[model samples]
Target: MTIHAVIFDFGGVLFDWSPHHLYRKLISDDHERQWFLDNICTQAWNTEQDAGRSLAEGTRSLIEQHPQHEHLIQAYYDRWHEMLPGPLSDGVAILEALHQADVPLFGLTNWSAETFPYARANYPFLRCFRDIVVSGELKLIKPDAAIYHASLRQVRAHLPDIQPEEVVFIDDVAGNIEAAMALGWQGIHHVSAQRTAARLRELGVGF
Candidate 1:
């Protein structure tokens, strides 16, 4: 089927987000930075927040578990905006191009509900998506069938006739792309704007 809609992953795909950015500023020593990320605020630990644990709840829990990192734990949520450097210009360009072409746009992301408002307030391009399914709001993360299906359902609710094959899901994460592919939605492992444009062209989405 001809691709009808585009679903984008927010952080890695459109924006550059890494705790390292914030932590690098907070913890000058690389070793200590790495240690804090691994032991105190791990990817897994952050995922809990993404999976719907309130930032306040998550931070409180972590601080309780690691009293030594209380200040740092509080910093994760307090300084959350520091982690994002802003949207990747290349991806933003593609999103604008797609929007200009009138392609139906949607977002499926695994981001903390508490922190997402900061993005909505700061980034204008996020408004390009017709609708977005946030994992934190739904308590489901990507690579899970639930989030994928939820995204599709949201799209269909409006369009009412879009097929799974008619949706192209783009993300920087391989696992999320793989999951979309398994669901019969076309998946593009976005690396750069030129590459993503080439992939979109191959799929017959006119710029």
Candidate 2:
């Protein structure tokens, strides 16, 4: 199928998405850090949050279950801005090139509703896309078929003839890429700008 659209993951693919920055800033102890990541940063808790659990409710649940680590809850809430440094200039250039080529661009991201506006302000390139599907807003996160379906639906509503195979979804996480591929969308595990550009070129998406 001729690729007609490109879906980009915001965090790692387009921006410097580092979870450890907040993790290190919050949890000082090494052992406690590992434990917190294992328990809280796994797919389950994130999936629950994406499934409409309020941030306060989710944080409260974690605090209640892991009372020993309750102090870290507020820190997690406070440090969201630390995740995004700035837009990856090279990646943004590629996205702009795609847009110039008249290819539809969309975003499928696992971002919290609370932090999305701040990110949008910081990265103007985010607004360039035709469609933006955020997990927190939809109450459905990535790797979940529902969210992917929702993203596709949103884009299709705008451009009725677009097909799933014609959409290229890029994410830094392997699991997200796998999930998109499973849904019959072209998926790219973003490593570097060179690789991303190469992939797009191979797909006949001119830079």
Q: Would you estimate the TM-scores of all the predictions?
A: 0.97, 0.87
Clashing pairs in 1: none
Per residue, candidate 2 scores C-alpha lDDT tens digits across 24-52 of 87778888887777776654775576566
What lDDT does candidate 2 reach at residue 86? Answer: 74
| Model 1 lDDT per residue over 1-207, tens place | 598899988887789999999998889999999999999999999999999999888888899999988988899889988999888888899999999999999999999888888899999998888998989999999889999999999999879999999999999989999999999999999888788899999999988
Q: What's model 1's lDDT at 171?
A: 94
lDDT of each: 0.91, 0.81
Top of the candidates by TM-score: 1
Q: What's the lDDT for residue 110 in model 1?
A: 93
Collision count of model 2:
1
Minimum summed lDDT over a 10-residue window in model 1 is located at: 6-15
**What local lDDT does model 2 show for residue 143?**
83
Cα displacement (Å) at residue 115, model 1: 1.1
